[model samples]
Target: MKIKLLVVGNTTDSLLKSLILNYKKRIKRYVNFEITELNIFKFRKIILTFSNQIIRLFIVEQLYRDFTIINNHPCHNQ
Candidate 1:
């Protein structure tokens, strides 16, 4: 089975990236895992102000959709 981890932005910290890669290597011993870092867009300040909690909620909700789709796909189990 293959598991794909999709991320919106690249991790800037070299140490952190190395740590993640090391963990991925260990995990790959038992499963097929891939990490795809996507550079979609740069963050820009929004004119409309929203509370931090509200912004977090919206982001989580949106991410949930992507995860659900990935999880439900037949490839997820293979």
Candidate 2:
């Protein structure tokens, strides 16, 4: 079983990369990290799924970098 860690970025840079890497290290035990470009203006509807779990939805912010979080599910795996 493998969990998915979604990291979205409105615009990516060094900071965003670092953020993803940092969070990835913490989350590596359970999930595989992936990053995607997003629209800052309409991030509210962006749904993040972790191993099929919708961890975040409808997040609104002027994001210039990345979004990071820690999550665990029943399917959390290596």
Candidate 3:
């Protein structure tokens, strides 16, 4: 299976980006991994369009202080 890491905005910090790339390289050795950076507008558009089909979303705060797991069910709308 392929794992995709999607970010709503660009990572401006050089150190953080380098660290992320290093981890990405290591992860690629075990599985197909990719990082996609999308602008806020496009990201929101995708979420609105696919909200009903999305099963779960894992979100991490900017400071990495906290994270959230959102679960969605199609039947919930019925």
Which lDDT tens digits does candidate 3 get at residues 1-78? 577777665665555566566656645654576778767685353443233212112122211111111222122214
TM-score of each: 0.52, 0.31, 0.52
How accurate locally, in lDDT, is each candidate?
A: 0.52, 0.38, 0.46
Error of 2 at 32 (Å): 4.8
Predicted structure 3, TM vs. truth: 0.52
Q: What does candidate 2's lDDT look like per residue over 1-78, in tens digits?
A: 444434353332444445545555655454454445545746366543342222222121111112222242333222
Candidate 3: worst-modelled 10 consecutive residues by lDDT:
60-69
RMSD each, Å: 10.1, 12.0, 13.2
Candidate that beats the other on TM-score, 2 or 3, i.e. the better one:
3
- The TM-score, computed over Cα atoms with residue i paired to residue i, of candidate 1 is 0.52
User: Best candidate, lDDT-wise?
Assistant: 1
